[model samples]
Target: MATTEAGIAPRPDQAGLTPLLEVEDLRVEFRTRDGVAKAVNGVSYTLHEGETLAVLGESGSGKSVTAQAIMGILDTPPGFVTGGSVRFRGQDLLALPDDERRAYRGRSIAMIFQDALSALNPVFPVGWQIAEMYRVHEGMSKKDAKNRAIELMEQVHIPAARERAGDYPHQFSGGMRQRIMIAMAIALDPDVLIADEPTTALDVTVQAQIMQLLADLQRERNMGLILITHDLGVVADVADKIEVMYSGRIMEQAPVHDIYASPAHPYTKGLLESIPRVDLKGQELSAIKGLPPNLTNIPAGCEFRPRCPYARDICKEQRPALAEVVPGRFSACHFAQEVLDGDIEPAQQ
Candidate 1:
């Protein structure tokens, strides 16, 4: 079995230079009529100051679920954090009181949901919605909050910020709406920012702009950023580290360039191959063979064995541990050495 690295992420409670956020042995489950679906299983990683960690995975691979859990937004009826802890600046968030957690939601940590239109209130003007953050958190007067909202709008490069501040959610284009979401998320300049698929539906140019804007904001504030998305193509230049998750567990973790150059896990290898390339135009785009497994009934042992081309008897009989494969990389594949040795084909995603 894979051994966890004592896996203690730094928190603020500790002395100096502690990590901004650390998640260790975290598990989340959802109850349904059928059974409990394990959404996150023993997932762990650390984010330092001004660092960006990009989580890449399939739609149901627990990317967003884990983020929701961190933000304290998961609905408890169906969802529960079964194990481990989420520590921010050394404070155990899971142990915080409900009211205290609510207080931390936007001021210390913030999230930009997948949909902006739904995230923003249709009845209220954009500025009112943004100002609400200040009104509620800092007790800013309405006029003062609205002026701050316009400043945020202008900072995000929204056109005619003062005028558009009065516009409703329906008035802005998709890119502009997304900017508005970013503006609100950063209003308090939270120490950590979690953007769940910030670019959902927009033209390629707009997507580039949004990502660039986020990068600039991170740089300007020196904030730790957690970018949760399925788009492997977008994170290459932005993220300092990459964590590839599958079937509620982390399959691979490494620095961004190392992961792109040579992934130690087969699933990460497959995901990399699946990226569309201009040079590979006219060739069929690669895809992982099957749909992600039903979490309620994840396969025994290695969850990815059935889909992996290099699966062996050992793979089927025993689950691989997410052990250190190299100095700075970790992979949950028994044959990680074989993969690094070029036994697996690169174009096999």
Candidate 2:
């Protein structure tokens, strides 16, 4: 198996500095009426400070689940963390006691959910919610917390922050509510920020604003950012590195420029081809054929072989481990070399 200097899977930590967050062989599952749905399987990655790693995959590819697992928010009874080690700042988060994990949730590591309206409580004033984060983490007095909350709102460019701070969730626009969510996320200056489709409910204009806001905040704080989004365009400007996931596994991972210029996995190529481009105007956009496989009964070898145009018998018989075909680029495919040689292309949909 390909290994980093740490004797683990190939990760960003191999070079030198320690990663802010390291997810090793992380797996999650859900017990549904049908069967056990393996959402994430052996997914691993490392996030360094001052870097944005975008996790790209269609819905249900376990991108969000992996983030939730790191944040200790996966609902039980149905969903459960099967196996993994979420190491943050040299400590294994999964192994930490509940109290310790709770302390880490919003203080050391924070998450911004996709829906700001639902994520923010409707009953309480938005300011109260933001203040509660500070109160809980820092044990600040109510007055001090409220003051800090207004400062945070101002920091996120929420207009009339002092006045709007007392307003409930419904009083704010979608974009403004998302800004409030961001303010709450950065209130504690967490070392890591996991944004799971942070711009999902907003317009293109608002999305751009939010992405820029996140980039600015990361730069100011030098925080590690994990942006989970299916939209390739969303990460183009923000991400330093990108991980392309499919059917509960990472198909390809590399620096953002490398993945866009020369994707070495069929799944990555398919995703890029699926993006609507100005150059492809009037032409039907390309899309990968077939739905993602059911994780309960995933294909024996290559999970993407059924939809992969370049698949061969070997791809069906033996699972391909992710390998570094080029410096700092990894792809899990039997024909990775062929992909690098530009011999394969996305199947014209």
lDDT of 1 by residue, 25-144 (tens): 999999989999999998998887777899998888999999999999999979999999999878999999999888888888899977898989999999999999999999999999
Q: Lowest summed-lDDT stretch of 10 residues in model 2?
A: 1-10
Measured against the true structure, the TM-scores of the candidates, in listed sequence, are: 0.92, 0.94
Encode model 2's per-residue lDDT on 204-285: one tens digit a residue. 9989899999988987787889999988888887888999998888989998988999899998988788888899999998
For model 2, state the Cα shift of residue 103 in Å.
1.4
Compared with the true structure, model 1 gives a TM-score of: 0.92
| Predicted model with the maximum lDDT | 2
Each prediction's whole-model lDDT (CA): 0.88, 0.89
